[model samples]
Target chain A: MSIRDTLKDIVDNVEGALAAMIMAYDGIPIDEITVPQSGFDLQSLSVEYATVLKEIKRAAELVKAGAMEEVSITTNQTRVALRVLNEDLFTVLIMTRDGNFGKGRYLLRLKGYDLARELA
Target chain B: MSIRDTLKDIVDNVEGALAAMIMAYDGIPIDEITVPQSGFDLQSLSVEYATVLKEIKRAAELVKAGAMEEVSITTNQTRVALRVLNEDLFTVLIMTRDGNFGKGRYLLRLKGYDLARELA
Candidate 1:
């Protein structure tokens, strides 16, 4: 399946998932998908999250904490999961506030590999 | 108990917990603690995380995602959980890779109020 198709499938199968995007570390979107009625600005969000991922990578390196594998942000309105696929790319998923974080994390980890392979 | 005492108690009680810190939104450490033998750098990590918290808050604001309540980063060697206490302060906890994230999250939430009150 194409990367975009896989991202669409993920959003379709994951309950409460609002959007998903494959972003570069430099704040650019490679591929993205969002539930049509969800009303999320995936473009702006992807850029903002890419900045986050870059800062996290720097912080991890400074602390000798090894590379950052994943990050999850929980807010009053939503949960965001980020998985680093490689040095230059990562994926971000946005879900409902009460969404299944464990399931979201699982799917991101599972699909990250496939995405990485396809990108390679 | 004093905030320092409470922080110490948390590390002492939570298994595999390496360190904890209370930091201002501007990347200042208000109070912090680390396990004697853990060899973790709470000072640097706290500052780095404060920057992260700041950025996440900004991103959430731009995206209109309401307020950011918590953020968790899982790496190869540790799990770091961050809870925003108020507009000016937040708490960060670092745990061993195998530590219980649920317990860590629970403790931060439980103590966040007390710390906020004391700071006020």
Candidate 2:
């Protein structure tokens, strides 16, 4: 099984999501499986989300630390979560409004850190 | 010397700041600060800012990791940079638009990591 598949399975098992997708930092879509469209502005959101991770990566370069582990955005309509997969890859998760966000966030963050070691 | 004073001096010493203040994570003003208001909101800005950190801290716990190192917000009018000084303390550098943001972000992020050692 691919890494992305593993992640999607874990998150989808939660039973309250409308849809979930893995988005790349460069606005590319990767490993997406959703029942129906969440109607999010993915392109704009990805760009804005990418900008933050790009800056964080730049900051990490300046600090000689490494790449970012995760980045997320929460809005009134919905919340988009990102986990940096590697220097060149990050994943964006889109969820329906009013889902179990706290649990989902915790799982992604913990998984993202472990993923960072592979990406590093 | 107090840590807050030191942070305030570093940002204020810049040639063209309208104002600079170090804000705590809980929307509390931690250090002495000043200036004619840039006319941008601080309280609302701070609360929104704090919410992000609170979430990040909670994620770190689930990850069994340390606290956040830094966070920042870039707006059309201005930028608010937060560096996690310790679990209880963080520094908010509010700088006017058109200043040297890249340089300032690098400095605060670098210093904030160093300060974490002192904090731990």
Clashes of 1: 0
Error of 1 at A56 (Å): 1.2
Residue B118 lDDT (model 1): 92
Which candidate tops lDDT? 1
Q: What DockQ number belongs to candidate 2?
A: 0.05
Q: What is the lDDT for A96 in model 2?
A: 47
Q: Please give, as one word, the docking class of candidate 1.
A: high
Q: Write the per-residue lDDT of candidate 2 for residues B1-120, one digit (tens) a residue.
A: 355555666566653344454556777765535546555455555555555566555543333333445454443345446666765767666665567765666667666665455445
Evaluate residue B8 in candidate 1 and report its C-alpha lDDT on the 0 to 100 scale: 85
* Model 2 chain B: lowest-lDDT 10 consecutive positions: B59-68
Clashing pairs in 1: none
